[model samples]
Target chain A: MLLFLLAAAVAVAASLAVVLGRNPMHSVLLLIVSFAALAALYIGLDAPFAAVVQIIIYAGAIMVLFLFVVMLLNAHREDEGTGGAALGGRPLAAGAALAIVLAAELAWAVLRTRRAGGSWMGAGPESDGTALQSVRTLGGVLYSEYSLAFEVTSLLIIVAMVGAVVLARRES
Target chain B: MSSVSTIGQALNGIVPVMCVTLAGIACMLAEAFRRRGERMPIGGLGLVGLAGAGASAVLLWGRRAGCLGVAEADDFGLFVQLVLVGIGVLTIVFSSDAVEREGLPAGEYYALTMFALAGMMLMAVATDLLVIFLALEVFSLALYAMTGLRRRVYASAEGAFKYFILGGFSSAFFLYGVAFAFGLSGSTHLDRLAAHVQAHAPAGGLLLLVAMGLLLAGFAFKVAAVPFHMWTPDAYESAPTVVTGFMSTAVKAAAFAAFIRVFLHALGPLRADWLPVVWVLAICTMILGSVVGVVQVNLKRMLAYSSIAHGGYLLVALASGDEVGRAAILFYLVVYAVTNVGAFAVIALLDSREAPMQTLDDYRGLWHRSPFMSGMLAVFLLSLGGFPPFAGFVAKWYVFTAAVRADQYALAIVGVLTSVVSVFFYLRIIVMMYMTDKAAEAAPAALPRVPKPAAAALWLSVAALLYLGVLPTRVVEIAARAVASVL
Candidate 1:
């Protein structure tokens, strides 16, 4: 419980900093921190595979790409005075209201699940508490049951690569 | 030996897609090895592959084969596969001239097109949500690149950017819906989902509804149904005309194939909950598509809206939710694909780098400039307007009949009314082509001759439209049998 709270708090704080940071570089770095905290939360929920993927993909590879893009674009601190007043006047209020409503709905759902004693944290038929996060089981299922999708994902990636080359290549 | 035989069975289900993929690879290799500025008949290679796919699909008809539990080559899927192959062949044929005219890289153009067609064919046949999503991404990525293939053109880039961002957003929505569905039923297979829904009808409740709605949003975006169709006009308008034809028809056909399977087959039990929502969507799409289309002057943009309204018609068929409705969808997809591709092929043939003709005024007195081109365009336009003795009329007639048979009078009425409104725009184009005199000062110095291949394809498409219109019973029976295999 304590670990969960700690990870959750760190995630929330880092995410808030990510949104609030003026410098684009600082925001990206903060997002990595938020992603790490989320990974920790995932670990607390007994999803080690998801947690590892979250750290590797989101915090490591994706963040590096983000940093490269930020550097390439030479992004700087956002100007606060440009359109702040106009955005904050009505749209901000409505956005905040909607956010509050969404948060409330999420909280109510979680509370209801807790009251019902439902295992909202990976307690389905396949969970079994142990083998759920095992890479061996995952590989077996992926190769046997989900092989078609796994193979097709390779085709999807090839298409994406070809598309990138097509769109980004010089017109010589 | 048994394992090998099982593998062979799996391979059998995907032979058509594999043929196309191999051709795409061959195109890539040819592109890499070719000398700079050396013209290659890459489109011919694509045609061979498409022909192979079509032949294989014909062979696979009525087989109902499954691949590794995720993909299936059911008759319904094979029928759509044949249509996609036809669209691909026509696109490649039409693109033979446009490729050089527009200075598009031939290898990338044909390769990407082959890959996109393969992905579309896979989408039609996939029985698992994850596979469908992957297939969607494959084609969508290829299409986004194709849309921006003219990298120097600002509108092309802008349109591609909008399509990519919006397409990514919809894909995320689709993945989310898949997750929700998995959460509810603990499986993503269509048959499993159907069984789960059958067992837990009305009990899965809100989450099931949310899943259905999200999935519908993804498909609606692909089909360019209203409220999710903001990206259609811009993307269609900016893409190379031949590409616009391919995506507008093939994508919708593939997406509709999956949409019908998922919504009306797997989630059919929850029809009471979803039917009213689809009814609302169908009405809105028809009204908005026709009304907004009436104001568009750009030929491609006008067709984009017309496609959206056609999507509305398909949605009406979906709402009807019967075997007749399913069969109507199959028939309509074929008719719409041939006719729309033929129309866009005309636009491509008429377009010249020096004189880029796209506007309504550009079409004025086109009959005087090139009588054959004008005549072909008139046939396409009249067919689009759902005139008698054309494919579009029969397609729309089947859709309306399906709706009426299902007791969806309001949807049928709205569909008929909006189609009537849409016909005005189609006729407006035909009128401009035939009636208005070309201003002497604005006359093009020289109109490009229609490439022989494109001209031949146009003639074939027109012949098809006439055949389907005048003697529709045979194809209608085949379509009915196709849907029967699935339902």
Candidate 2:
């Protein structure tokens, strides 16, 4: 519960900073922090595989692309008022209210389940949804059952590469 | 079949696509090897690949094979594959002069076109939603670059940028829908999705409805159906004329093929929930396409609207969801591909760097200068306008009749009325060509000298359109049988 609370707090704060920040670079940094916090939450939930992927992909690769686009778009200015105050604070208030309602609903569900106290989450002989094992099975199924989609993804990448060259290459 | 290994099964199912893909790779290599200004027949190489794929598709007809249970080489897919190959070949045939005239990089252009065709083939055959999405990305990426190939042209870059942004957003919506569907049902394969949906139905889940809505929105954007069609006119108008032709015909064919398989075959049991939505979409597409089309002066934008209206007619057939509707769709695709590609090829010839010749005023006196080209353009325009003894008339007649037979009277009446309304624009072009009144006084637009390959493509398309229009019986039966196999 403590870990969940810490991760939730960090995620909420970082995401709020992402939207409310005056500078695009600051927003990007806050978005990265939010992703990192989400990854930590995933790890806390026993999904270390997803947590690692979230770090490697979202926080690493996609963030790098975002940084590149930001720099390319705003090379002349270090900090500009891109997401300025025209986006009023009203939406944030409504958003906070919705978030509180969602949290309250979650608490209600948990309390109701506790009152009805069953062994639905009982420690039993069944698999406990091991993340590592699930990832391995996913790999196996992707290679065997979904090899078609896997191969075609390679084709998509090639097309993307060709497209990048076509769009960006300098003529002699 | 039981004894067949997975590799062999995949090999059997993917032969047609493999042919085209191999050709794409070859074109890339050929482009790399050629010296500057070396006129190696790169486009010819593309045609050979498309023809090989076409031959393989014909051989695969009536012999459905599943590629690892993901892609299917069914007659329906093969039929669409044949149409895409035809579109690819004709586009390549008409592309050389445009490529040369623009001083564009030949290798990239031909290679990208071949890759786009290969992707379209994959989309037609893919039975898994995952594979379909990949195919969608493959073609979308290639076409985006193809649209922006003229890097210096501002409109080209602008169009590609708008298309890419919107295309990426729509793809996200589609991916979200797929994720939701996989969560609701345990698989992304259409066959498995059908089973799961069947198991959960009449008490349909909200999540499922949301999934269908997202998926339909993605397809509607792709087919340029109204409300989601904001990108079509600019993209079509700005793309090189040959690329526009190929994109409009081949892209729409592949998209409709996948759309039919998903909505009609997989989510068919949920038709009650989705039919009214499609009905409204059809009505809007027909009304808006025709209404907005009448005001366009640029030929490409006008054709773009016309294509949107044609897409509505196909959606009308889709809404019908009957045997005749299925056959009508196949027939209409063939006719539409031939006529639209031919029309765009004429546009290509009339276009030059010094003079784009896109405006209606530029077409005046075209007949006096080049009788043959003007005659060909007139034929295409007449065909597009749905004149009797032309392919468009037969296609529209088939579609509306099928729609009416399925009790889609409103769709039929609307479709016919729009077709009549659309005739004005088509005739406007023909009148520009045939009037000869303003031939001397109009702008001295320098039409590109008729390239041999383009003329050949025009003749061939004209022949195909006439064949389909006059003798619709043989092809109609064949289309019926092919679609029946899937059902």
Candidate 3:
């Protein structure tokens, strides 16, 4: 539980760094840290498969692509450095809105004792509703009940594959 | 006999999905075999496939009412399918000219479109979280590739990269949420989750709320809601105008349809829990979408923000959690789709080699240069602004009424105010065309001839907008039936 809290804090902090950092490369790196910490939270939720996949696909592959673009485009230096933050004052306002949301949620947690009335102090079942077992269970459900949706998913992947090839290839 | 029956049942269950898949494959094969400069035939074949899917959807509609499967095919899904297929048809019409100009592989374009449409259709019917994730990625991947089709243009390629990266990030959040929901609910089937939610209603846990929040974030990105909407303007600005038209309408429709299904069915029991969250989103989306759009000089970027705001309006309808609200969303979606695509179709036609001409300054004195184009554009812009006797006005009326009906009067009032704010931007274009003389000489002089197919699409869009505006009762009735049938 403490580890989960620590990871959440780190993720939150890293997210702030990613948004507030002036350097594009630094922002990208902070995003990677945030992704890793999120993976830890996924693991804490008992979704090992998802945790592993998140780390591998998101932290490893996707973030590398972002870093690659940052490097390749050399956008880090040319990102209109000083005025980028001032392009809109909305982000700071968005942060305040998010804080309000958090406060509202916290207040609801404190006031609401209608049924399973108690403090949310890790006092009950650790089942986060969708655990790793649920993922495995979903696989079974996808095969047996939603098999068609599964096949459609595969077809979509194939189409995406072909599309990427066609789009990226040079004119013949 | 039992095996045969089982196979038959399986095929029956998979028909809607199969329709799109088979059509996409046919388009792919046709593309492979087609020769150069004979791309028209390929485009025609792809349209035939999408039309067939639409026909199949019509054929199978209401026939699978109680049939057991991984997903359900009801009137709601069929409505979404029809809308998506219609968009696909319009997309071809809109892209034909642009495709010719760019010298793209027509085969790939048609095939990717079909594939994306298929994913969208699947999303509408998907009853499982994993299926939803997969379907979302399917469309997202196709869009990423399509956005980069003009690879020689550095901005286009960069836009694709940004969309791809951000899309992957959001997909990860979706999957994580799915994991959390599965952990808490002990299942991923939306129906089963609903049942579980009801069983544990009073015993609500942070786990369910967290799962819901994550899922919301994922969809927030998909719908391009504020905060998660950072990628939209860049992407829309950089992509080909025709592609932008298709993406803005088709993708938004599919994502929002899935969103409605998940929230209304799976989380229906948790209405009290999520309603407030959605309320805030709705307000933020509307205000930001309208206000920011006014400041954008770039036409595509302005429209992108407009799309974000529209998504918020739809969210407001969804937040209402009433039968009237659901039906209003569908009605509003249809109206919005026609007006938006019509607007884009005109914009696509106006582009030239020297510059894209998407800025308001470039549009100055457009009426003097090409009356027919500017006139059509004025109608679309007015419709977008919710002017009287136009579809946008009716759509907004329905949505806001739904909000009022649900007792979210504050939201409804805010919706009205933001809508008023939105009018300024929509009118800005009109004002540029009529009132300004800033670029009268600079504006292109000759109006272009409309291709037969594109003309059909444009006319149909205008007709639909007019028909829906003047007499929306019938469509509203159908929308009500569709929503009720699903619920």
Candidate 4:
């Protein structure tokens, strides 16, 4: 329960920082922190597959979503002005948020080890034999029953690439 | 490990989707080589792909094979595949004009349509939650890109951005729901989930209900149903006309096919809980779509709402738990697909960059300028209004009959009343076209020239609407037969 509370607090604080940050760059960075906290929460809840997906897809893939847009926006960063001096309290808010997240992350680590009588590398308290098997079964099914779907995902990505090129092509 | 004899049959199941995917790659490669001045028949390449897919679907009909336990090559998927192919063919035909007039990149447009169609087909056949979500993203990404294909139009860019974000949000909900379902049942396959749900109901009911709601929200957004339908009009209005037609029909058809597969099959045991929620959704969608559609002056935006109401009618069929309701969905999909595509084709033919005749006023006195197209438009509009001797009338009748059979009298009553109210909006276009005077808001160029292929497609749709209306028995039989293997 204490582990849950700590991870939850970190997640909520980091998520708040993500929305409250004035700079898009800062917001993107904070979003990653929030996602990582959520993944830890999932691991605490004994859903390791979901935790891995949370890190890989939600954090990794979605970060690409924001990062690409931020890069696009970076080209016009000099043209667009930042929040003025009237909005100067951002760092105080950001620092408070990060401090809360750091404190909770440390608390979670302490609480998690206490429960499992194990270190961070140990299997989570509630997890048994099947937790590790979930990823293997997922892979087995993905290759055997859903290999066509896997192949199609590649095609779908190619189509997305073609579409992006077509839509963004400015010259004749 | 399976025998080679069974392998041959399972391979047949993948053939249709393979045809479409290969053709899409061809179009992409062709686009890279073609010179600027060269006029390539890129749309023709897409048509060939759609035709090949259609033929393969016919060959695979009633096969009832499962491809590696991930997809079912049943009558249900094949029937929907044919409908998608038809929609793809018509959209390509209609796109010929839009491609030339709008200076749309032909190779990109045709390739994207084929890819989207392939995704829709994949969605229809997929029997697993993860595959469905991936298939959902496949088409969603392509359509999002197509939505912004109008690069110069700022609103198009805005619509695409809004669609992308909302679509991504909905997919997340869908994925989370799938995760919950897997968490609950320890399996991602619908058959396994269904067996688990059936065996252990009255326990963890609330969690199941929440999962169902999440899944429904994702599909409702795809089908453009009420409350979840905020993005429909903007996206439809700003997209290229042919694309709007393709998505408004094919996306909904594909999504509905998957929706039926999940709700009516996997969650069949939980109907007592999910039905009332979907019932309320159906009634609100029908009411709101028709009433707001009446107020829209823009043709594309108006049709967007009309399509929303049509989705509600299909939802009503879904809410009514009976074989008739199941059959009604297939029939409605076909008739609705034909009429809506035809209607949008007329709008596409009459539009150009300078004089984009998008408004209701723009259609005024259209009969005087192009009698052929005006008459065609009249037929499509009348069909949309549920006029008899038109396919929409037959489609709406079957939907209401299913609702009545399930004792959903209130939904049936509301459906009939809203369809009548919807006629007011449909006639609003008719009044502008044949009834209103010529000079009210005449543009400098009276009618945008209709290309030969698009004109042929419109006439073919008119014929289809008439055929389905006059002798719906054959098509109705096919629709009925399509639902039998799955349910």
Instruction: Put down candidate 4 lDDT per residue, B191-294, tens digits, no spaces.
Output: 99999899977464778878888998888889888889999998999898889988999998999999999999999888888888899899999999999999
Candidate 2 local lDDT, B1-487, one digit each (tens)? 6666656766788899989988988988998899976789898888888889999998888889768888999999999999999899888888888888887788889999988988999999989888888898899999999989887788999998899999998889888888888888889999989898888876678999999999998888889888889999989988999899999999899999999999998898899999999999999999899989999999899999999998999899899989889999999999999999998988887788787678887787678777898899888888887887888889888889898998989999999899899999988888887785655554565567887877887888888888888999899999989888776
- List residue ranges in candidate 4 displaced over 4 A: A1-67, A75-138, B1-10, B202-204, B440-443
Instruction: Give Cα distance to truth, residue B450, candidate 3, Å.
Output: 2.1
The per-residue C-alpha lDDT of model 4 at residue A39 equals: 92
DockQ of each: 0.62, 0.62, 0.37, 0.46
Scored by CA lDDT, what does every candidate get?
0.89, 0.87, 0.82, 0.87
Q: Candidate 2 chain B — worst ten consecutive residues by lDDT sum?
A: B436-445
lDDT of 1 by residue, A1-172 (tens): 6877888889899989977777888999889988988988887767888988999798998998999788767877766675457466687788789999999999998889889878765433344567354966887998989988888888887888888888878878
RMSD of each: 7.4, 6.4, 12.7, 6.5
Q: Name the candidate, 1 or 4, with the larger lDDT value.
A: 1
Error of 2 at B426 (Å): 0.5
**DockQ score of candidate 4?**
0.46
Per-residue alpha-carbon lDDT of candidate 2 for residues A1-172, written as tens digits (9 for 90 to 100): 5777888899999999887776778889889999999998886767878898999799998998998898768743444443334567877788889989999998887778678863323222334767768888878998988888888888877788878877878878
Q: DockQ: which is higher, 2 or 3? A: 2
Off by over 4 Å in 3: A1-143, B65-68, B437-447
lDDT of 4 by residue, A27-119 (tens): 787889889998998777778799999998989998989888987778323223444435588876997899999999999987888786766
TM-score of chain B of each: 0.98, 0.97, 0.96, 0.97
What is the Cα-based lDDT of residue A15 in candidate 2?
Answer: 95
